[model samples]
Target: MAEEKNSIHEELIDETVATETVEGEAVEASEIEGEETISLEEQLKIAEAQTKELEAKLEEAENRYYRIQADYENSRRRARLDLEASEKYRAQSLISNLLPAMDNFERALQMEVDGEQAASILQGMEMVYRGLLEALKNEGAEQIEAVGKEFDPNFHQAVMQVDVEGFDSNHVVEEFQKGYILKDRVIRPAMVKVNQ
Candidate 1:
């Protein structure tokens, strides 16, 4: 009966050892799975870092887009201003072409006359001269008067000089060709003789 009891005790000890071995194997497997989980976590962190980098690049791209848009808008504004300026100055060439006619009128008006028919022609020429002057004035044309004034190199060109008593030196004595201005800028300098 004692032998039977010892055999039963040994069987129970063997079964306990087998169960402990199985449990040890299961613990080792769990450790390997934990290592794999840690590697997966590292991969996820790398992906997150890449995503942040991409977001920063996108932000920079968006900033560049806004700058380009602003540049385009400024270019458009400048173009509009230039077009308006060109339109405003469109009549300058036409007015410049009519200056010779004005000179002819001045010469005709200065000619001597001795009859009623000549007087009538003179009156008609005066009317035409006044009309032409008015039209030029309306289009921003101005005349520079140099006679009896100080000779300024900016507005007057000295063609000849004469010694004159009782007149200030370097003063304009006669205007040869009248100077003209357009939009406050001198288009032609006055040709004049200066008193020496």
Candidate 2:
């Protein structure tokens, strides 16, 4: 009876120890699972931050591209305006050369007027001629100097050389036809008679 009682006590102690070991192992496994959850949360937060940073960089790149495109459009518009202005004034030099001929027409009309109606017609034609000249002059048209000035090959052409008593040599004696300049460049050289 005494040996049986001792054996029963030893078996109860072994069972208690086994139960304690199993509880300890379960607690350790729970702790490892908690650590793994925390690590996964940290990785998620890092990924979210990287996504935001990439979005910001993409927005900045898009803004720069739009600004460059706007600048190019503005440059193209300005070039077109400049080209239009050039086309409008393309024939300014040629029309300016015709001013002297118009003046001669006006003088002839004035000297040959016979009646009130005739004089009125001549005045109307002169007005038209003046309007045409004014329009050309406003667009970079200018007349070249010829008569009574020193002969310059840059602005004048000697159609005939004349021996004049009073004028110095190489002086412009007469302008047969007027010349014209445009924007400081001689478009048509003055046809003149130069002194010998």
Query: Against the true structure, whose TM-score is highest?
Result: 1
Instruction: For model 2, state the Cα shift of residue 113 in Å.
Output: 3.4
- Highest-scoring model, lDDT: 1
Candidate 1 C-alpha lDDT tens digits along 1-112: 4565456556444433332235455433323434332343454465556666877999999999999999999999999999987776666788789888999999999999
lDDT (Cα, tens digit) per residue for candidate 2, span 1-196 = 3465456555444433332235455333323434332343454455556656877999999999999999999999999998986786687656756666765865665577789998898888888877866766787766678888999999999999999988989999998776777776676788899999
- TM-score per model over all chains: 0.64, 0.47
Candidate 1 positional error at 2, Å: 78
Q: Tell me model 2's lDDT, rounded to 2 decimals.
A: 0.72
Model 1 error, position 73 (Å): 3.4
* lDDT against the true structure, each candidate: 0.80, 0.72
